[model samples]
Target chain A: MSDAAARLAYDVIVDLVGRGSRVLDLGCGDGLLLARLMAEKGARGTGVELSQAGVQAAIARGLSVVQGDLDQGLADYRDGSFDWVILNQTLQSLVNPSLVLNEMLRVGKSALVGFPNCGHWRARWHLLLTGHMPQQASLDYRWYDTPATRLLTIADFRSYCGERGINIVREVFLTDPDGGRPTRWPNLRAETAIFVLAGQIEGRPRQRP
Target chain B: MQPRSVGIVKTEYVELFQPPNELRLDSGEKIGPITVAYETYGTLNADRSNAILLCHALSGDAHAAGRNNEEDAKPGWWDDMVGPGKGFDTSKYFCICANVIGGCMGSTGPSSTNLRTGRPYGLSFPVVTIADMVRVQRELMRHLGIERLMCVSGGSMGGMQALQWTVDYPEMVLSAIPIASAAQQSSQGIAFDVVGRRAIMSDPKWRGGNYYAFGDPPLDGLALARMVAHITYLSEVSMRRKFGRRLQDRERYGYDFATEFQVESYLYYQGDKFTQRFDANTYLYITKAIDYFDLAASKGSLAEALREVTAKFLVIAFTSDWLYLPAQSREIVSALKVNNVDVSYCEIESDYGHDAFLLEVEEQERLIGNFLSGVAREHGIA
Candidate 1:
């Protein structure tokens, strides 16, 4: 009955957030991770969900969530308003994941981004044999019906961080929620990846750029 | 966790202030000997921090839940959400719902006699605003010896009171849930109220609100006002779905305006039933209070108005509620964010319109119960 225990990502996410921390969860479906974080870590969280049902479900669980689109941007929030901003299994589906990640960094002291690694062994084998976009546990739909708008791998995301001058403070590779094995080659072995990041700290007030 | 129903509640009254301790209105005037009619469920814990004050909407009375007696055909207005394990959960938290000061239902409204003239105060009663209503309730809370409340909540006008409590007495309220309401009255809402008040004032029998002395009340005017007010509470979708072009009783229309449609009959029935219990003067006064309500008028900005609010907030709006649209609730949420307040918002998907707060019981129960549970946990209520 406790859906919180069923998701291993929630355990890892909850562990990363500090006790009594203020959290902002983007694309927080039903707020399962946020709810567990509140109960276990005594954290307070606000969620933004595009789906009405997800918003209601989050509210039903006693978490404050707003019905809003991620593409619309987080203009309503102030700078560094939250201790942590979380986006789990939702980065790849967004219209502009990079912009959202930057906005998250602006509004939160730290950001946690989780996404499915498209370069996993299963996805690679399926694409090589079938010559069609692969679908597996993380990508559980046909190419046409998939919500994963873009494909990304552990390496692509790391390079994106480097190019944008974003710092990856921590990284975790998971084959699946139940399979928490750490891998030497995440892009080839891991089905999913989570990264904790901090935006480049300003050394001093920028003088014209 | 589904809450079990708590059955058979009771209502009581308490005299809060008298003479020297007269309740002061936001307008600087004062009223003496205020008697608050209220209903309480569950027991107040030793610390008394488990108390929740439930403020009612326009026509709602203090009878918020449970049946008063076996003869009563229906339970209270919020009966579904205020039981043993329901949204307000009478078992764990002490719930208090009071009839507002200007209400006609067993409260010191215009219907009460004026000690100076020994006649119903009627139009002579000083006009009170939403802030005045909250001030009276605060006095009532002091009378009951509860220093701090676990939560203050309501929808529509009730939501205004909840919001006001947070701004006016920030230290008293621990949490606030303002459902389907706004920080200020919308122009469209004011227009509706204008027509309703005109309906009463234009009636010949109204006699400038002195109809009480004649004992022949302006039932037609009051009924018409209620009819006009009721239309705003529903949406076009609900009206189309519920009545459509369906005829009333007869197979065919009478070819005249003799209650041809079922929707007409329903409105007439609702309006007629309303006249039996409500006072016309009270309708005029309360509606005026709602019209005059603008929290930011004196504070310069909404953020400034709510700067003192420390209580955690949950602001709810319904998608189909055009009277108090979701945008209005967003204004509140935006201001709260500007002040860096702890706030959460949800625009529920409902076609029930302004009445969704009353009709969407299942959704309200879950959301409210969980919110209250978290707050209760924080206060060590469990």
Candidate 2:
């Protein structure tokens, strides 16, 4: 696969992974992103995939991956064990995205979370036009069979971070990594967004927006 | 039982040290002319980097796979996972399993006569540690011209050796699979071993480890030890499924204490079968060594112990294995994670308990096969 074969969101996430840093990829499916991150960024990577087949595929690629449920928590990992903990395309599928987000920041010095924005204009337009839940490639599955239990938008994530005192170190819209950060209406324009976050220190003032 | 092509399979013995080339034990005692019984499957490539060391658990021999003779009814202990197309995949990788130093199956143990005393070492044998066991295996590897191993894989006590190899000789190993093992033997584990030892020592036939001259050979004591230890290897769920409160060979219990329960009969059979082959003194020595294996205590903490490890690790645990619970494996994983060691862990769902490493074959086969293939690719081993 070419370096550009990764999803548009991964391209942006890979850039922020930096060089030679340790990474823990939560809900790593087939470990493609971790493998790409390792190859391109010189990052030492580990994956925690819940499925046996996914774990097998990752191992086949010569990647280190453990099989475990994210909902059960990352208790096996120590505090700040990894330089970056990534949750890509998996945030919406989590049983408790809030608790998992807390764990991601607990185990990793910095967390990079990528998720589809439910509040995208297309989704909103589909809901307004058809009077039903949106169905798109980013959120492709039917509501009945979908693994996504929680669907949140960029606005929702920003608010959650604010409430949890999580410092948003960096945010990038999937459609534009090099372009200036989408300052005006990312919740409406961006299909998916990646946020680099760190837990706020006790004495420091929280970053609200 | 299926028809499968076998690989190059044979067992051999090698004398590592001589009178001059003494092997100094961790206790600072010396033993030379040590013999190690080993079996190898598949061919070692020119570089000899395709070798995967398979360490055996307690009561396990060097015969890891294949049958010794046509008349033999069963294959090696880990036959399901060590053949041509099996987990270790002898067809692609050269696999070696050696009888540990303090074992009874052909390796120099309490059963072997000491060169200096002209008699079995018995109680006089220098107590061996997990590290010492690895040291002996290293000597065997050196003698075999294997500069580095592709991977070292094992479970339980075997897993301890695998983990020890990673900590002790990190550069020499490319990867490690330590399944159903812990960084240190838990206190509860020690208590079980203590009871096992007590049963052996209490036997009048034991004669303070000088019972080799007698005909009986402390069978009762050794059988009792095996019975106790075997129970620990299995889970309550498995026991309930297999035996429950069922009676042996009858519709109802005889009501007397003469092995009425089917489980009792099964344990008796296991105990009897074990005594037919195993040496009682070796049981004492090996258990003592296993109990003494506290990697964390020796190296400070598990993190400190694994701090310098460069080899990737796959640490496996079983859900119901109370003997070496998943919690223990997690401790090792936590340390590896803390030290930034590349590690993978799977707490497999199984009712087989600690014996799951031996009994629950499919998941391990898949995991190990994939992990080994991955490691082989990394090491450029065809």
Candidate 3:
């Protein structure tokens, strides 16, 4: 909701998008990332968001956005539509992330997924000391009214990816937007991470440091 | 640099039979002074009630039937269908065609002057919807003293605008025929248009929407956009049959991006020719409006939208049109049924894709002419 969080998302998108790939933004709020990708990188792209206000805002910004519900899979798209399909900070909010992610992989050759880490030290410490899920800056809502349907850890995600045979091409560990850089012990410390996954097996999938 | 002049294949303008005209845009912008570039063959009846409106498609102008002078070898694009005793029956109906707004022809669009700034509007033109296009046609008719049109018809984007007229203003139209049109543009449609616009803006010549001063427009981008669209207008089967593995003046590949196959050459020519006439900004606006189109979404449901229409309907779809499939046309028929509207539906079996509605002369003429005559008899148009 804050400007800082939005800017951080934009920066990550800038680093992830290729020079000339067709990009599709899922839950593309206001299409900020899409506009940047199209303008600066010469990438062709559009956004899908359910909110009419968000769609209108994106269109006014001269970015293409189609109003759509996430539950309806990306069946409308032909095969190999986009090189990159992005789901930024919207993975946990979906009713069925697995189904949506599968649809994403079906439509795009690769995907960039960024979400708050449930296994971060702060979150773990809160659960260890108290009995409730930690209310952090990113995941700031309480259990009673939070939009997050599932709380997932970095390890749990990687394990699930392996079980599904989804090749993880690139894994990025992140601290708070303004905080220190990520190092070896990311699972214990980093609050967020970005993963690039492909549906089929490919050479050197991981670009981990 | 010298300006290259190609040989004149065909060129002419259409004269307005009824001089005075008024046009109202969907944005509620109306025009009193009018100029229509149209061609005609037959005479108007004494009552002038046998007028048939012919809607033009996107990137198409108003020149139909023939040129300004009578000595041209070839006729206009749809001349085959709108002739004496033909599908349109120029002998019976005063067929009229006008270039749609946001069109590059004589009609007003982004390239047209702002009238206030005294400069080309460029991106400043207000976004006009399909309904706005119909409003302009209705105004043109009203100015010509035409009340209750005998039948309104067109294909592709023109069909889209015609459909809008039936919903937006049914009283003005007696019978409506929309060919190869979808009730709503799917998300994939929006995606393609978004890419096309992005391609145009990506050109350095685009110059952030101020390219008019540079004397060099974004021709490459516009051409690329057109090539992308041209692909959708044709069927895969047709493409395969016509240009499959046919080498372009060679036995093998050139190891470069030059036109290697016949298909590539055809597409390149189509795109290259298109950029010369179409305003890049108008293409952006019109295509965006098409992407934003959802007749059902506007009025809550397709049935709800058709409930407002008092006119009879005849909708047609091609079997091979992947761009706007037969299922989409059927959706409109289903909704019309729910509203208890008198509607006839037909899905023509053809391999011509979306272009079939434009290219197939005999079949289209027969269907359209018969439908119009039926509407005329019921409505008592002379």
DockQ-wise, the better of 2 and 3 is 2
**Backbone clashes in model 3, listed as residue pairs:** B26-B132
Candidate 1 per-residue C-alpha lDDT over B179-243 given as tens digits, one digit per residue, 9 for 90 to 100? 99999999999999999999999999999988987998888998999998889999999999999
lDDT of 2 by residue, B1-382 (tens): 4344353357799999887888989999988789999999988988788999999998999999888877677888998898888899988989899999989999999889988779888888879999989999999999999989999989999999999999899989999999999888999999999999999999999999988867779999999999999999999999999999998888875777787888999999999999999999999999999999998887778888888898889889999999998989988887887777778888888999899999888888888998888888777888
Better of 1 and 3 by TM-score: 1
TM-score of chain B of each: 0.98, 0.98, 0.89
DockQ of each: 0.56, 0.48, 0.01
TM agreement with the true structure for every prediction = 0.91, 0.88, 0.60
DockQ-based CAPRI category assigned to the predicted complex of candidate 1: medium
lDDT digits (tens) for residues B347-371 of candidate 3? 6668889889877766666567666
Backbone clashes (count) for model 2:
0
The C-alpha stretches of model 2 lying farther than 4 A from their native spots are A1-8, A11-22, A39-43, A69-83, A93-110, A120-151, A163-191, A198-209, B5-8
Q: After superposition, how far is residue B222 of candidate 3 from its true place, in Å?
A: 0.9
lDDT of each: 0.86, 0.86, 0.74
TM-score of chain A of 3: 0.90
Docking category for candidate 3? incorrect
Candidates, ranked, DockQ: 1, 2, 3
